[model samples]
Target: MSAPRFGRITAGPAAPAGGEALSELLAGGGARVVRIASRGQVDPEGAWYDQAEDEFVLLLRGAARLGFADGTERSLAPGDWAVIPAHCRHRVAWTDPAGETLWFAVHLPPA
Candidate 1:
């Protein structure tokens, strides 16, 4: 079998002007990895993420704001990492409008 390719995590083209792009990097055995490119995209009104698996996410570049159901918010800068437990309600409150925000998210031990 061919070996898996390992390369720059910051690869890929820029996200569109005002939309967010998500690409699955890996997935197997109840776990998955995804890369997100955001250009000022925010979670829709009253929408929340109730993921089935725990997620460990890192802000690769740019900045973002994450919001929880408890009404607290977290601002993320490059190199910031967050581990969110499964079932915790959360959302992307905001992202950098002037530039692209890159994210690496890994879902652990699926639901």
Candidate 2:
């Protein structure tokens, strides 16, 4: 027997929140892709991402800023991509206020 094959599909955009958006772009498999948006909101200190799953992200619109645990920061713009390792702590520092940011995120876990 063989596993079923999946095809390309559209994804749902995130709401007004500043979290990752899960969609059907990559579904029915171990991996998943989501569309996210940011509205320039900052989470409280100590709030970070330490998920066991690896995350790959791309900025499609507007500007994004990332703050790392090592006290380093970086800015991202449209067409920019970032790969965050599993268990890495990071946070969103800023976002373009003129408009919302369109981001695509993919989650990959150890096989």
User: Candidate 2 lDDT (Cα, whole model)?
Assistant: 0.73
Please give, for residues 24-62, the per-residue lDDT of candidate 2 as tens digits. Answer: 465545778776766665556668878788889898877
Instruction: Report the lDDT of model 2 for residue 6.
Output: 65
Against the hidden reference, what TM-scores do the models get? Answer: 0.92, 0.76
lDDT of each: 0.91, 0.73
Give the per-residue lDDT digits (tens) of candidate 1, residues 1-111. Answer: 969878677786578877888888888898999998999888886799998889999999999999999999999999999999999999999999899999999999865
Off by over 4 Å in 1: none
C-alpha displacement of 15 in model 1, angstroms? 1.6
What is the Cα-based lDDT of residue 109 in candidate 2?
62
Model 2: which residue pairs collide?
none
Top-lDDT candidate index: 1
TM-score of 1: 0.92
Please report, as a residue range, the 10-residue window in candidate 1 with the lowest summed lDDT: 5-14
Winning model by TM-score: 1
